[model samples]
Target: MTDWQPSALQLERIAYRQRRARRSTLIAVVSSVVLLVLVAIGIGSTPGWPRVRATFFDPQRAWEALPVVAEGLWLNIRVMLICAVLIVVIGMALAILRTLRGPIFFPLRVFAAAYTDVFRGLPLLLVIFLLGFGVPALRLQGVPNAAVIWGGAALVLTYSSYVAEVFRAGIESVHPSQRAAARSLGLSYRQTLRFVVLPQAVRRVMPPLLNDFVSLQKDSGLIAVLGVIDAIRAAQLETAIDFNFTPYVVAGLLFVALTIPLTRLTDYVARRQGWYGGGGGPV
Candidate 1:
């Protein structure tokens, strides 16, 4: 048979759709440009704009601070990567403990529940301060009293609590029928979780997991308060020299740059997993 071709009406419909899409794209681009131009004009016309620009948007200071801030950002990258792994592993373990059945597992469930509640309720900054300062003050032998160690521990503890809840939600979302089916197939509970349930649960929660990591990536900057010499601390030092806020802007931009990719990946995964609609719908 010869290749099929669209009829006149079908061809007309196809052409109309293409034209509509192009028009929509053009309108979107024009609207965005006009809005941006208006915003720039408004800001530029402000009475204090010149002074504000000199203080916060100094190109020279930004250029000079770029190398230092970027180097400091590398520390954040290393810490975040290390903490992310620990968060996932600990979170998964906590989730599993919380989900375990039977009276024998009651104490584990209680412990997991209490841990999540306590950590989730407490402010992360407070946790960081407590761990970084309080822990060091105790000064037990063989314990690392460094702020970096305790601050990183604070991050892992707080983030793992939240991440554990996410994992637990994913685990509970896996239907009981799945567990029953696994049991019928002669798989033990652990085997079922390992081979069947966790795979699907983890897949379902991949988007949320990435979202957590994105937040973790940003929060890694908080360690600067503990004097970890990360991007924020570097920016603070630069600010002290001239009180110009350019280094802060630069550091913030770097974080946004890093987080944007993970944020986009999360959206992509959400769309793929049918948790989003028509490219991206509210989830």
Candidate 2:
């Protein structure tokens, strides 16, 4: 078959479609802005808006709370960074263990399965509470007694289970033919997995992994319950002293800001990878 080129009419149709799409997008953006403005006006004119504004949107209070909340947010950022690395490592290891084929590896597969089931099913709050309170209560010799360590451990455990499932799904989605081909090339199972399967699996699962990271970012706030004085806790302290909720709002905004870039990055990667049919080009 000769490589067919678009005729003039076809090119014109393509240009028309592009123009229509741009117009639609512009209309949607304008309409959304209008709707938002109307909603803001409606809320601003409400009977209780003054009280609400004073409590939750006070400019001076927000300014006063910004520095403290930002400081506390730094702690959350640190925990998130540490937990993100640990969870990905632990999750990949668990997924690899679960994927092993030999009878000798049965025990490990079973353990990995049980670990994912239990951790993924449990509420994160409960895990945080148990690890934060229970571990320290034991006062084990040489174990760190710090709430930060305990909270970080809990986050790592909870998030790893979820991330493991993502990795497992990605691994399973790879064609069996690829594994067969690798083995035929004299690659051992471990070597095939290391050099072939895992790289593709990780690429396929990047978007979901990033989504889980966003969840992890928000859940990092839960560490506040352990009294690690993260952003949320800092907001709570300020609110308690001032009898206003502005600080909490500020803290929430900070968290939102932190996650926005990650979310955008996820979308960008997904598009580049042609995920959700958002085909930027060939993968």
Candidate 3:
């Protein structure tokens, strides 16, 4: 094959655009950091800051709040891990069912569509409330035994719909030739999908999946509305008990501390994925 390359004009245009993008990204990131620092300094340096600091940093008060914080952290982690696993399995199946062509697929598609629309359309608070408080009246006696169950189930149900679409997109993005070649190699359709299409699709979709997981982690706070002892709820409880907002501030800081690393990791993964031809390997 002959060496082929972009024209000089095209190369120059690409270089200029790359430089512009890098400059814009750098400026935006720096501006955001500066703004955050300014706000933090303002809050910490304001009049009465000493009282607030003393109250918030009190070791006795802090020790008392630790149990609630720990409980909330456990609840948050439990909900996230359980919901994520359930959503991935259920969502992938729904996505495949939605894509498969058949009379059987019709109702599956409708169900998936309706599920996504209903959950995405409604506020998460409403869903959690309905599941936790409202569903008990119908005497749905199987799984929802308590507020936590209903709350976690609602999270899984709502996010699964969104995850299904991600899986569907990933699956469909695989080239038709890959599927055909898999079948031509004497593999069953199911076998081919399992071995070839899905793996590639998953690599392509991993970043978005991680983004959704982060959102899920944050939204896990909404469980507080359902009377679950989530981190935010624990903070609120401490606030109510002590008549101080320090607990809430402490909780906020904890969440920020936890999520900041995940956000940075997400960005790092995205950059590495790009460098590794979108496979998230080696690079």
Candidate 4:
């Protein structure tokens, strides 16, 4: 094998691009700092700034609340992980059902479509309340009605509907010719979907899948409304003790800390797939 290096002209182009990138970075950093400083000055000049800071940004209260909120944040993370897996599985199953061919699948397609429509249209908080409180109100025999359990179920049910649509789009994006080729190779319908279509579909849909998981990470905190004792709930309890909102800010920061990395990964994947757009205003 021959090893080749860039020509002098190519090297010059690379150097030019690096210089431009560094210049852009410096401008962005300076502009961002300036904007933040201006905003801080504007806000600090307001008479209520002192009260707002004392209520929401008290460093001592944040320090005291950190351990409690962090501990509760773990529950939110666990719920997100568990619900993410379930959402993908159930979403894919619904996608397959919706995409099935032939007259026999018509009813299934109808059912899947209806399910997605209903869940997507309904408010997620309502679903959570229904499952989390209303079902437990029945007190069925041998039924465990934990708030976390029902809250997680609510997340899975609602998110699976949206994700099913994403998966369906991916499945449909596969070329019909590929399925014919798989069939000509004596592959059954299931085998064609599993081996021929699904792999490509999944690859195409990965960026959106990561975006969904990112959203799930944030929504996982909503389980706190069900009295799950997750981070938000912990913050609420803390606020009641001293009427300080710093715990809520701490909880929010923790969520942002956890989710930002996944959001960046999603952006990277979207760019890698050439799906990057909507980054600029209309020309």
- Native-to-model Cα distance after best TM-score fit, residue 121 in candidate 3, in Å: 1.7
User: lDDT tens digits, residues 199-237, model 4?
Assistant: 999999999899989989999988888888999999999
lDDT of 3 by residue, 96-174 (tens): 8777767867987888778777877887788898888887778865745677788888888888888989999999999
After superposition, candidate 1 runs with Cα above 4 Å error: 279-283
lDDT of 1 by residue, 20-121 (tens): 999999999999999999999999999999999999999999999999999999999999999999999999999999999999999999999999999999
lDDT of 2 by residue, 63-152 (tens): 999999999999999999999999999999999999989899999999999999999999999999999999989989999999989999
Clashes of 4: 0
Candidate 1, residue 54: Cα displacement in angstroms equals: 0.6
In candidate 3, residue 87 scores what lDDT? 89
The regions of model 2 sitting more than 4 angstroms off are: 1-22, 278-283
Write down the TM-score of every candidate. 0.97, 0.91, 0.77, 0.94
Q: Candidate 3 has what TM-score?
A: 0.77
| Number of the candidate with higher lDDT, 3 or 4 | 4
